[model samples]
Target: MLAMNYRGPYRVRAETMPDPVIEHPNDAIVKVLRSCICGSDLHLYHGLVPDTRVGTTFGHEFVGEVIEVGSTVQNLKLGDRVIVPFNVFCGTCYFCQRELYGNCHNTNPQATAVGGIYGYSHTAGGYAGGQAQFVRVPFADVGPTKIPDELLLEDAVMLTDAFPTGYQAAEMGDIREGDTVVVFGAGPVGIFAAKSAWLMGAGRVIVVDHVEYRLEFVRGFAQCETVDFKSVKDMALHIKKMTDWLGADVCIDCVGCEAAGSALQHLTGVKLKLQGGSATALHWAINSVRKGGNVSIVGVYGPTFNAVPIGNAVNKGLTLRMNQASVKRHLPRLIEHIQAGRIEPHRVISHVMPLEEVADAYHLFSSKLDGCIKTVLIPPGVTA
Candidate 1:
């Protein structure tokens, strides 16, 4: 089967790979119907993630039909369409019991520094990702969410990571009704942060980024204000002016590594103590929030230490909340919203192509094409 495989830095190709089969009795083989590139994928695309294996399949966000279920997999059966959570997890682990599936101890080895991630480092268990014709789903009963027939896979696929990550960032920031929020980075995940913040009853949302296209796109969604970081001499003032001279009540960072700064030099005042592509939008969020406020981060950082001044955050009474998405806790509700048409996340999906065109899609996504807010890979013969 042809898949998007990592060749080297800034290089992903459509190449033939071994067909997937059940590796564990609890595993299931999913015939992928739709898959999408994540902002994290860019970490490798830009040569940020170290020790990245060559020719490894490179994606985790996907929806698929169950081609075969393992002997112990009774909850999902063949022909069932489902959304696979980006984090492969066993539902019964200690972390999972606490509603934190992203840190499932079973899938992530006992001593994993960072939890397992699909197509990421071996520290992440190097599990094959969903960006292929078929994916081997570990802990199928616990990880792969069975999508209702009324729901579209393209819309729900983002639930695996992007939407859930965005929601987690906002929820962690402790957004309150009538609160004003600012989200750094206007990529897919950041856009979801804007959407989720408003859905949770935020009075105003400000999205900061240089991408005019994304800022313009945010207008289609109600109650969002956009700030082109390139145009501002003082981003803090720009945010304050939009929010009645008070800084944002809550802030979220969704574009992690890709949003690493020093790109905006015109801006004055406090800059997040960031260097190179390390601190990312999370640092910006910390700088953008009001004193005594909160900054939530869902952006994935590479394996490195960033110097965050704990004293500065403490002096201002700022709270920091961040994590990979705990999808198990939020998936059901997000899916329910999708099923109810309460959120049309599909608006972010701007491209669709056959699996054979996987390489082309990767290049387009890697380059961040004009119409490519998100690109979903539809396997052959996938209908609706």
Candidate 2:
């Protein structure tokens, strides 16, 4: 099978890999039909995430047809079309029981902070991802959901990660009716976060980013106001001025780890590998929201300290919430929204390439070239 092979920082290519087989009783072997390049995948591509071993494939958002299943896999069978969530979790664990599948304790023995994630890295349980012709899925009954007849495969693929993560970011905000919300970053997750904020009854939604194309895309896609952080002197101050000096009721950070703002942050965190990742977005969110307001973060950051404004957060009585999105937990409501035409998840896709061209797909997304917002990969032999 051909898979996206990780060589090192800024290096990935399509290479021959052995086809995956069922390794556990609950495992399933999925022949991938559609997969996507997620924003978080860039972190691994750039070597921002720790323990990302060489030769590992990197992808977590994928949908496929189940070609084979182990003895214990009862919910799925051969010929079932399914969409697998990013998280590799056991459903009966304490965190899973609470619907926090992203933090499941039974997977990823290397760390206790996060559960196993497909194709992330060794720190994420070293599980190979679906950026291949085939992938091994653990806890098949709990994680892989059969795609509904009414859903498009492209849409189902996006729901695996970006959509759910974005929706979860909004849910973490606990937005009240008529509240003013500001989202940092205009990537897929940020766009979805902004869109979901409206669904949660936010009176106004604003997206902050320095990229001109992304800002324009989010304005049309999320139907929200846009701000180019590069044009402003102080982003936090600008947000305060926009809100009549009261600041926004809620602020979200969708640009994690690789946030490009502040010379010191970029030099130390992203360049020097000193901290987990740049905390520029987190800094902006902490200082930009109204005192006693809510702040939600769905950005991917490494397990380490960031130079954040803890003193200001404590002084201003802000409510800070963050976590990896529990994709399984949000699927039902999101599916309803998609089916109802309230949210078109596939609209975010800007490019689609054959799986054999996986390397070029990565370059396009990583370089943000060709007005790319999202890119989906089609496995060999899959017509769609």
Candidate 3:
């Protein structure tokens, strides 16, 4: 099997690797058909996340066909086409029972903070991801869902992470009727969050990013206003002015640790590694929302602390909510939205390449070249 091998920071390649086999009674072996390079994957590519061991695969958003299943895996079988969520969790644990799948206690060694994440790093449980020909799926019954007959493979792969994550960001906003919502970052998750805000009764939606292509894309996709923060002298003040000086009702920080804005934040967060990741977006979210409003965060960040505006948040009485999306918990509604043509997930896809070209795929996405919004990796046996 050929898998994406992590050599070091800013380096990944397609290398020959042993095929995965069922290792546990609940484990299943999936032959990956369609997999995506998520925005969060950039953290691993840039070596931002801790404990990302070399030679480990890095992918969590994938859909595949089941080739083998262990004795205890009853929910799935050979030949089943499924979309596996990014989370690797046991369904019966306390957090899982409460639908907090991302914090499942039974799957990860570092279970105090985050549960096992496929291909993330050792800190999230050193489970290999699906950026290859085959992947081992633990607790298969609880995570993999059969792709709906009406859904496209492109959309199914996105549902594994981007869509559910974006939707969860909106859900956390607690948006009220006629509220104004502003989402920072115009990546796929931000795009979906902006669109989902409309579904949740937000009267207005605004997406912020410095990339002109992304801003233009989200404006059409989410039917929302756009803000190029690079053009504004004071981004928070701009948002306040857009919201009639009170500030937005809900502000979402979809840009996590790798966020680029001020030179100071970039130097301290990215270059110095003093903070977990850049907290620029978080700073804006905390300072730009109306008093007593909500701030929803779905951006991926490391476990370490980053410089944040706690004093401003406390003074404004903001409700801050954040967590990894429980993908399974939101699939049904998202599937309905996709089937009904309300949200077209595949429209965001800008690049698709073979699995063997994983190296180039990473470069394209990481560099943000070719107007690349999303990239999908198709295995050898899979058709485009």
* lDDT score for residue 382 of model 2: 89
Off by over 4 Å in 1: 110-113, 263-276
Q: On residues 124-145, what C-alpha lDDT tens digit does candidate 2 reach at each position?
A: 9999999999999999999988
User: Which ten residues in a row are the worst by lDDT in model 1?
Assistant: 265-274
Question: Between prediction 2 and prediction 3, which has the larger lDDT?
Answer: 2
What is the lDDT, from 0 to 100, of the residue 265 in candidate 3? 80
What digit string (tens of lDDT, one per residue) describes model 3 on residues 1-384? 999999999899998998998788999999999999999999999988888899999999999999999999899989999999999989999999999999999889775878999999898899999999999999999899999887899999989999999999999999999999999999999999999999999999999999999999999999999988888888889999998899999999899999985788888788777888889899999989999999999998777778889999999999999999999999999999988889899999999999899999999999989999999999887888
Instruction: Indicate the TM-score of model 1.
Output: 0.92
**Model 1 steric clash pairs:** none
Please state the error at residue 155 of candidate 2 in Å: 0.7
* Candidate 2 TM-score, C-alpha based: 0.99
Clashing pairs in model 2, backbone N/Cα/C closer than 3 A: none
* Clash pairs (backbone) in predicted model 3: 257-278
Worst 10-residue lDDT window, candidate 2:
261-270
TM-score of 3: 0.99
